[model samples]
Target chain A: AQTVTQSQPEMSVQEAETVTLSCTYDTSESDYYLFWYKQPPSRQMILVIRQEAYKQQNATENRFSVNFQKAAKSFSLKISDSQLGDAAMYFCAYRRGGGGSNYKLTFGKGTLLTVNP
Target chain B: DTAVSQTPKYLVTQMGNDKSIKCEQNLGHDTMYWYKQDSKKFLKIMFSYNNKELIINETVPNRFSPKSPDKAHLNLHINSLELGDSAVYFCASSQGDRVRGTQYFGPGTRLLVL
Candidate 1:
C-alpha cells in the first residue's frame, strides 16, 4: 500500500512571499503520479499541480510548482507570490500510473496554510 | 457549469437512520469515484465506478452501498448510520484510460450522524 505523509500540520506565509509545503510518500511501484490539491473554506477541492514520477523535470503551473525527487520519495509543493487567496488546506495525493487500481487516490492528512497580509 | 455536483450539501441524521447522497457529473467522463474525508482530514477512497460498472470497492463496511445507474451518476446509500460514519463525502470524475487522468472534484457533502 502507498502512504503519503505531510509532516507539517499548519503553515503560514506573508503575502507576496513564497512558501513550500513538504510531502513524502512510500510506494513500491516505479510508475506513479503525485498531486497537490487545495481545499478552501468553501470546501471545494481544486488541483494545484501534478508531477509524473518518470519526469526528471519538476512541474510548474502559474504560481504553483512541485519539487519531485523520485529517489528520495519526496514531492514538495511551492507557491510563489502567495496571496490571501492561497490560504487553504493543502493535500498531497498519490495514484498508481497503470493497472486496474489506477482510479484510486491515496491522500495525506493535509496541511493548513495561512497567508497573512 | 459545474463539472461535478453532489446533492444535499449537508446531511444531519440520527443513529440507525438511512440516507442517500446523489452525485452527477456533466464532464462526460467515463469514471466516477466516492471518497470519504474523516474528522482528522484523512481522505480515502470508498468506491469507484467506470462506465456504470463497479471497478474498485475498498474495505468499507457492508452498511455502505454504492449504486451507479449510469456512467454520469453515482449514488451512495448508507444504512444504520453510526457516529463513526460522520464525515465529508466527495464525488469526483475522470476519463477512464490507461494513464493517470486528472480528476475533477465536486464540493463535498458534509454528513453528521448524531
Candidate 2:
C-alpha cells in the first residue's frame, strides 16, 4: 500500500513571509501524481497544487508551488508571501496512475499551518 | 455554481439507526467518491463509483454501502450506525482520464453517531 508521510504536525509563518511544508511518500510505481490540499476552518478541502512525476520542473500556482524530487520520492509545498487566510490543515496526497487506479488517493496525516499577522 | 454538493450537512442519530448521506456533482465528471475524515483528521477513500458502477471499495466495513443512481449522484448508506462512525464525510468528483485530472471536493457532511 502507498503511504504519504508528513513529519510536521504544525507550522507557523509570519504574514508576507515564506514557509515550506514537508511531505514524503512510499510507492513502488515510478509514474504517479502528487497533490497538496488545504482544509481551512470552513472545512472544505481545496486543491492547492499538483505535480506529475514525469515532469522534472516543479509545479507553481500563484503563491503556491512544489519542489518535487522524484528520486527521493519527496514532494514539498512552498507557500510564498503567506497570508493569515492561508492558515489551514494541509494534506499531502498520492495517486497511482494508469488502469484508473480506482480513482482513489492515499493521504498523509496532515500538517496544521498557522499564519501570524 | 458549486461543482460538488453533499446533502445532510449535519447528521445526528442514535446508535442502531440507519441514515444516508447524498452526494451530487454538477461538474459533468464521470468519477465520484466517498471519503471519511476521522477524529484525527485522517482522510481515506471508502468507495469510488465511475459512471454509476462500483470501481473501488476499500477496507470499509460492510455496514456502509454506496449506491449510485446515475452518473451525477452517489449516496452513502450506513446501517446500524455505531458511535465510532462519527466523522466528516466528503464527496468528490473527478474526470478519471489518467491525464492529471484533478479531484474537486464538496463542502462535506458532518455525521455524529450518538
Candidate 3:
C-alpha cells in the first residue's frame, strides 16, 4: 500500500511571504500522481495543484507550485505571495497511475496552514 | 454552477439512527467516490463507483452502504450509526479512473452522531 506523509503538522507564514509544506510518499510503482488539496474553515476541499510522477517539470498554478522529486519520493507544495484566504488545512494525496484499485486516493494527515497579516 | 454537490450539509442524529446523504455531480464525469475525514483530519476513501458500477470498496463497516442510481449520482446510507462514524463525508468526481484525471470535491456533509 502507498502511504503519504506530511511531516509538518502546522505551518504559518506572513502575508506576501512564501511557505513550503513538506510531503513524502512511499510507492513502488513508478507511475502515479500527487496532489495538494486545501480545506478551508468552510470545509470545502479545493485543488491547489497536481503533479504527474513521470513529468520532471514541476507543476505551477498561479501562486501555488509543487517540487516533485520522484527519486527522493518527495512532493512538497510551495505557496508564494500568501494571502489570508490561503489559510487552510493542506493535504497531500497519492494515487496509482492505472490498473485495478487506481481510483483510490490515499491522503496524508494534513497540515494546518495559517497566514498572518 | 457547482461541479459537485452534497445534500444536508450538516447532519446530527442519535446513535442507532439511520441517515442518508445524497451526492450529485454536474461535471458529467464517469467516476464518483466517497471519502471520510475523521476528527484527526485524516482523509480516507470509503467507496468508489465508475459508470454506475462499484469499482473500489474499502474496508468500511457493513453498516455503511453506498448506492449509485446512475453515473451522475451516488448516495450513502448509514445504518445504526455510531459515534465513531461522526465525521465529514466528501463526495468527489473525475472524468474517468485515469491517472491524470483531477478529482473535483463537493462541499462535504458534516455528520455528528450523538
Top DockQ prediction, candidate number? 2
Quick one: best lDDT, which candidate?
A: 2
Could you report the Cα RMSD, in angstroms, for every candidate shown?
1.0, 0.8, 1.0
**Candidates in descending DockQ order:** 2, 1, 3
Model 3 residue runs over 4 Å out of place are none
lDDT (tens digit, per residue) of candidate 3 on B1-114: 989999989999999999999999999998899999999989999999988888888889999999999999999999999999999999999877566478999999999999
lDDT score of residue B108 within candidate 2: 96
Better lDDT candidate (2, 3):
2
TM-score, ranked from best to worst = 2, 3, 1
Tell me which of candidates 1 and 2 scores higher on lDDT. 2
lDDT of 2 by residue, B1-114 (tens): 989999989999999999999999999999999999999999999999988989999889999999999999999999999999999999999998888468999999999998
Task: Rate residue A64 of model 2 by lDDT.
Answer: 99
